[model samples]
Target: MPVARVVVDVMLKPEILDPQGQAVSRALVRLGFDGISDVRQGKRFELEVEGPVDDDALGRIHKIAESFLANTVIEDFTVRVENGDAS
Candidate 1:
């Protein structure tokens, strides 16, 4: 059976400071990657569904992202379905 893959990308809010990302940026510059001005670290979650994705499933996934995958106060997230993601 085919499976549906949903991706949730979570990131710190723009106003929130990202020390980890800053450190990476500095490291990249030291390693000869000078063109990069900045970097921001985030998280990704991939969820597998047994059937095709629908509006109701999307809504449920969004709720899961809001409640468990991301911090609403300091982070933001986006949910999207992978068109051809296969294991």
Candidate 2:
């Protein structure tokens, strides 16, 4: 079996509100940073897996994202492999 590294980015949809990011931006403004308009927050996931490189593996990864990794109601996720994965 081959080893694979996966990097996933999960982010809230544009229509969704990001209170934590908003608060951070506001704090930045209060600290004298200017011209900052909006802020959004997201999550990053990194993992290693063993599998063949194929569409079925990709689909299984997506299912993992949908089942446990991402909040489907307000967020979307993207999956990518690092260039040197060798799997």
Candidate 3:
């Protein structure tokens, strides 16, 4: 069986407020990172698929991300497929 890897990145909508991100930004400023402006926190999920990875598989993964990994109402997600060896 062929193996593949998928990465899902989840992020909050632009209109949503991210207190954790803001706190990180403030901490950066206090640490003398003056060039920093804003910050947004997000999540990454890496999946190792044991079988062949094709368009159909990617589509399913996208659905899974939408249904389980992220809150569609306030967050958006991106999916990336990578060759198994790259991982």
Best by lDDT: 1
Residue-pair clashes per candidate: 0, 0, 0
- In candidate 1, what are the lDDT values of residues 59-85, reduced to their tens digit? 999999999999999999999998783
Answer with 2 or 3, whichever has the higher TM-score.
Answer: 3
**Stretches of model 1 off by over 4 angstroms after superposition:** 85-87
lDDT of 2 at 54: 67
Residue pairs of candidate 1 with colliding backbone atoms: none
Candidate 2, 6-42: lDDT as tens digits: 7778999999999989998999899999988988889
Model 2 alpha-carbon drift over 4 Å, by segment: 85-87
- Candidate 1: worst 10 consecutive residues by lDDT? 78-87
lDDT of 1 at 31: 91
What lDDT does model 2 reach?
A: 0.85
Stretches > 4 Å off in candidate 3: 83-87
Ranking by lDDT: 1, 3, 2
Lowest summed lDDT window (length 10), candidate 2: 78-87
